[model samples]
Target chain A: METLDGYLDMDLLRFTTAGSVDDGKSTLIGRLMFDTKTIFEDQLESIERTSRQRGDENVNLALLTDGLRSEREQGITIDVAYRYFATPKRKFIIADTPGHIQYTRNMVTGASTANLAIILVDARKGVIEQTCRHSFIASLLRIEHVVLCVNKMDLVDYAQERFEEIVAAFKAFATRLQIKEITFVPISALHGDNVVNRSANMPWYEGPSLLYHLENVYIGPDSNHVDARFPVQWVIRPHSREHHDYRGYAGRVHGGVFRAGDEVVVLPSGFTTRIRSVERFEGPVEEAFSPMSVVIRLEDDIDVSRGDMIAKPNNQPRVEQELDAMFCWFSPERPLEPGRKYLLRHTTRSVRALVREVRYKVDINTLHKEEGDVQLGLNDIGRIHVRTAEPLLYDSYRRNRLTGGFVLVDEGTNRTVGAGMIR
Target chain B: MTQSYQLSHLDQLESEGIFVLRETAAQFERPCILFSGGKDSIVVARLAQKAFWPARPPLTFLHVDTGHNFPETIEFRDRFLGDLGAQLQVALVQDSIDRGRVVEEKGPNASRNGLQTVTLLDALEEGRFDAAVGGARRDEEKARAKERFFSHRDEFGQWDPKNQRPELWNLFNGRKQTGEHFRVFPLSNWTEMDVWQYILREEIPIPALYFAHEREVIEREGVLLAVTEFLTLREEERTERRTVRFRTVGDATCTGAVESAASTLEAVIEEVASARQTERGGRADDRRSEAAMEDRKRQGYF
Candidate 1:
């Protein structure tokens, strides 16, 4: 939502930055915020004071975004750190996920809701195992755009062939998974090459700079706009009001467009109802679409609460008892065992699910799917067969992220143990 | 006229907050919303209400009481929870002091504000809560702006901002090796202007202190302190009646207000839009030092 006066409405863009530990993910974010003048005066002052206190000749950009006292001390990103900044063109949310193998779960969580992923690679090292792992997770989460930032191009003399080799390598691996859009940009984030402005060294390159790509990327159609899915979050009564008969189903639209008077089918129970009103605090609206939170009133009072999805009757998701899906195990203490039951939460519906079978584990480096062996541990990505107590309405992960993904909660521990995407 | 898309500022903020709340519920073992009946916390409670529909919020409300609060805030808190049928758990600072876990400051201007950490940490330990959802916004303080979405705390309830995890993308690192807690902020993206615009659009219920009213006050540190039972005029200080409104609510001793005629939500939004100073400018505690918020957060302060 942009403001009226021309100041950006902090049109937040959530993107992930991934690379080997030394690729300058933190430094790049720091530079973006610093150069854009997003940092507060006090923050800059403190950083300046701290820099002088540390006896550094120049202010360290990495110290700007790194908050953890430990991460600053150890010089590594251990958890996912979220930082925000805004330019007149757009507001951005940077998810600074870790590059280590042990922190793979952190990358999954960061990319899950991102509109884009910035996969940073060292120009000297080309494409490494961490680069492939980050790219694979981005694709797994259905991130639409990938900007391959060839960092430290200064070290490689800004050679056009080096950028091509890295881009070719990434495309080959990304081909094994579902990746729609990919852009290759050669830059030195440490030396400020093609980050905010076009680089002078890369004479052969002709594309926009990193910031330009981030500002102009087509993210309008990022959310699914084809399938109508609205999971009722609450029943708003607001008693003792002028309109006492108001029974509005409150929820944020997951997919497609919802118009007033449109007929919708409530899931789990095939009850149908006509849309009575689509109300925000601003009163009734003519239509509502994905990512819009509105209270939808229906003609008939259908038994809908949290976990019940409303969708178009004709384009309904498959109601299946058995689900074939890929899941990323998030916990190290527990292993994915067959015949174990978990509280599987899909969209708004929650049901008991058992691990029916283990399919195979995926190898990120070689882009190979290992079949036959079924032991899934922490950060392990594998396919499995799940039988739910109730049938789930789901689409392929590529079709829609909202209705296509689900989290498995451990019954006793209450931790989100795994995340799944329908095959 | 068919408009394809237009997200009201309030709706967008609510959606984003709800998404973060759900992520916390899905990621952490035990998460609780820190409710103080203030506008920020009320917005958080409302977001939690929206996160899990059909079923009441899966978590509970955790209120750390310093035994010195506006009766209106307490009354509003109870009524709000009652309407939603959500559970409420209170942690008393007085109880902690009485139990010798914390020492009450012995002075006329003494507030149990800083001593709240002991009660807060004790409650977390007793409840076994791994995640505590706070209403802190980045614009509130400079140190807060440097905070991550999921700020991790060690076993001793000390926040090591230096060693924080690298959070990239929408992916949150909710992993805790053991005995560690996370302070999850769903409203980290919101600014004071956004909050005001949202309050105006959503028509969220707020305490009376936010709106201007006639009240007796004493001037201190270039601030107009409302004279309540908890606050008294010092020998050197003089009292006066002024029309004032508060930007934030804390211990009656440290919180202050600005003189304004913005009594309605729209007016407040306009006031926030035109104001050049930050919201926390009126807050006395934060003005103590540059690292005030960071120091408090390390001591388990919300």
Candidate 2:
């Protein structure tokens, strides 16, 4: 997918940013876009005009990210805002999550698909509960790369000791969570230091700039490539003139790889088959790997449809009626009741699940497991057990995020009440 | 040659989009691609074709005709749909006005852009569609940037951005109440440059209007407006021939043309790569207010 003129196709890096309102999350993103010269003139003009109308001394860079009228009117970010920019080295997609107690669900949503998470720490305030909260969520979502941006360093006189103290505190909390790699950078987002370019004030800092690190970070190993999981989304049956009876199971390869003539077993049915072809829009490929959406044609008509999982025979997922998972309740009205029935949607499949038992809830601020509080309310993280009507095929959330994650929908209300990570 | 294990940016985007399209078909009972015959929607139509491949898209295309669209786009839409042998369901704004369901605004800047929501909602209700897939990218506007791949709408077809379902990973939550439907955007992550780059790489045919040519246009509110049949020139405005092309296609009165000499896909890509303003920056409809698009989307405008 390259042009004839030798246009280099850059690899994608999807990352999420989390910070409280006015913690410089939007400012950092705005600086990234601005320094990279990705901002179009018209957009800048509009933002400038709006800034002038608002009577700001300098053009507000935060206005670049607070896009919605309501958010701009209030001068704060409410929902998860997505921003895109590219350097010559790599392309980036930033899922900007708001840092509020009620916006925990949004943080989960934004970091769900991100390979990296940027947890912004204010140099003035140091490591607060919100910092620990963000880091815990990032690690919970399995984001391997965490960059602790100690922002507003100019206010602290660009102190290296201050940066190290916060870094040390973060590592101490991160020890309780599963975080693979952590990087520390001191940045003055408003003054443009150590974000895209090296800062003159912080002469002792030797690590790569934020942009440099983002562009060079190895994200290829971020996904789980050992397990082969293709949750069949749609069965492409194109009974046409040229290609009649084309039954291709269309899905994204969430894990591992699939090749032509590979042995695969369709889940729930327990029917084994060989792949006839791994076809993409370009043409038939020799093999297809994780995240590539392709139509897998089977050698036999084994009666597979949506909600079915196609996997390698050797490495199959656990299939059972009863399951245990760490669930994050997302609804404000109702608590996670043991007797409640929910539509447990996993990958492409959804089944009626009954809460069999209530587990202890988590006190995020203190990182303690509260035994008595079995009730899971809005933004509450707790372990729970459930038995679904139909068998669910899943892997551990620690092993794979795509196949292991699910959302619970209330049967009557149809609202997504909870997000679960299979245990 | 052995296949490389990595996918290009365009390939990744294509795959993600295809996955979204398939998910809609699998989850919802009835879904339609909201086609406006614009470049973005045309790419969406092509992606829909690729998603099913040997089969047709398996979904009807709901084109909410503003009755103020470019004739060229309509012609392109007919030809493209005809080639695919896909079903076309047109929801006309003229019908909405005739039935007194929506009133046409009066003024020199009066455009049916905002009124298209009524017709689109009526069409969705009439068709009993649970999903209306669109080509809106997050990079296009601020409000749309926060929109989910599976955006839930209330029974009145209103979008509550504050109360959206948390869309996690590729698993989209399409469950809704009896009358509520979802507006799905597969291209939420794609940028304008990515779209052009994809169009160039795939060599997909786009409308000639995307390329610059001599056109009768008038400058209004610091943006260029093409002289279409629906357009009424202001007393101070005068139409002139300029080498310009459209960054987007919508109601002829609202969508503006940009000054360029681009004529080919490669040329358009190059121009887009270096362009200063966003595709929607010149759009009069989006310029009505900072939250105009947000307000329209809340009311079910595509």
Candidate 3:
């Protein structure tokens, strides 16, 4: 039996994939899972049966990811589907999203929590308009790492010049975006070249395979640790007999390090106190950091409830009623217009907000701003000014994604209409 | 005072599960955790305990009993709930059958797994529960791969796979009409291997059916099924005593067992890690058709 130590110590990495209709995105994901031996024998049999029934010559690897019946029948992905696989080094979560123009909202949803993105570019077509649009979305969502997979290299005869030309063209266009790290790889996902193992076909290429890069990428510094931010989600006040007057603030630490005896301030109320203890289910800990859920007990009693934020007194978030942000409209039926009221939810707080003005709309394909189109329809990206009924504690989205992001809800239909990032 | 800031995969998954549980408590007026005495639900129940430590979770435990469950599972469920000091509401398939709410399938291959959906929906309506927290993981099946953490259901308790709301970041939209409810899955990101590893790490108690044991069984269509009164045997089918363990717990008629000697938690984890077949591969319900799970989920099956 294999030891459980390696499995227990493995970390996690979440990445998103983007490609056009014919870029073979599903095939790429399937290849990664298959070559790693993560695909079970039963699943392979099922896919093989389906492929034979569809009268395909070879086993269609894409059949593994197209889960929904509609997707299988129409040969298109309709929404986001999550897939999982693990190696000895790390566990991976793939947010496989559709690549159609109208499915921009789905891609945004997938990219919101991802640390990296894999954008597939067909070798025959080189970089096209769809490539630019996918890259822009990745930058807009603040994904730090990107792997540009030039797929179907077998079709291009594994030529070194063609791969270099595509890389150069993509690099020139990428200068406009704020992507911090970019790695270019040439692979043929259909024949399983350069996905999991070194390909003998492409002897000129000298780099780690796609899976190797994913397992070794430095995502430890991806989370913000300079500023402390915690949005209280619940108040745990057990009315049991053993302990009375036990009030603790329950939340997941958004950023920075929090320890016992540290001075902190509660937002909106402006009450300051010292942290008495930082406790998890096991016991009290010395310190807690980003993404760890724990209960914090303060030295003094104060009015802290749901939707309240706790942060260090020295480093506090911006408290303002009027704010500027970029909005991605999600509702297909309605367009965002000035002077309209909606419910804006930020952190844990929700309040009424009005759209004051539309500054400009971004043409994602060309990376150009159209100042004349003031209204944002479905899948349109634009900057707008919003005035809330209550002041919000936030930071610029470029600094902290957890504190600076929000969703707008339409009251009438009770549907999430838009997502915003603080500017 | 110096430590790596990064969390291990298990710790991250635990934190995410706890966060979702807390969100469920704060957002909905009334919620319940669907307990099946299976490893997945057992892990969920433990997370709920940690999520609201020093206090019993405000949510109740609801079990949709199919009357075809293994006796060991039902016994485990009762004892576990007694220890947790939480409330439990059992919706019985037998009661639904008595009321003619649902009809039982007849033949050599009859099972009440499909009948549990109607009883579950009826119980949710009667209890007026706004959220039903389930222990479903996306990696368990193909159709479940697209499920959201906060899955919305209409008033009729039907799921629309086509028109789902876009879930972004940690923000979940729980707003709904009066009669409509939601199916919240805290374990949507967990894989089968993760579930077993968590159970081993936390020392959570589960039904003995998960460990190797001797029981009367019959081999049908390459699946080792427990020989219970709920199952009707054919002329050629013969029962034999075998040492086996179950990978998943469900209706006795559908859940299958595998031959194994891993009787301890460590042994089970080792078995799961090295196992080549998917956990649900042994389930007979999923073998009905290519879209069996999707079709059942659309009609409000858990």
Q: Which has the greatest lDDT? A: 3
Q: Quote the positional error of residue B272 for candidate 1 in Å.
A: 8.5
Query: Candidate 1 docking category?
Result: incorrect
Task: Enumerate residue pairs that collide in model 3.
Answer: none
lDDT of 1 at A76: 73
Candidate 2 regions off by >4 Å?
A1-8, B1-4
The TM-score obtained for chain B by all candidates, in the order given, is: 0.94, 0.97, 0.98
Better candidate number, 1 or 2, judged by TM-score = 2
Q: Using DockQ as the measure, which candidate wins? A: 3
lDDT string, candidate 2, B144-255, tens digits:
8888999999999999986687788777888887999999999988988888777877777778889889999999988999898888878989999999998898889889
lDDT of 3 at B35: 93
lDDT of 2 at B161: 83
Q: Deviation in angstroms for B88 in model 2? A: 1.6
Instruction: Write candidate 1's Cα lDDT for B1-302 as tens digits.
Output: 24545453345667768767776776778899999887888888877776654346777899999988867778888998888778999999989988999998866567778889899999999999999999998656645655767788888989875446444323355656578889998898787666665665556788888898888888888777878888756788878899999888777777888899999876776676556455666677777776677788888899
lDDT string, candidate 1, A302-385, tens digits: 688766788888878777889888788887678988889988877656789999888899876666888886688988998988
For A264-322, candidate 3 gives per-residue lDDT tens digits of 99998899999999998899978989899999999998899999999999999998999
Tens-place lDDT per residue, model 3, B14-118, is 999999999999999999999999988998899999999988999989999999989999999999989988899999999999999999999878999999999
**Superposed model 1: Cα runs more than 4 Å off:** A1-4, A7-10, A52-57, A237-246, B1-3, B6-10, B18-39, B42-101, B106-111, B118-134, B138-186, B196-249, B252-300
TM-score of each: 0.78, 0.97, 0.99
Model 3 docking grade:
high
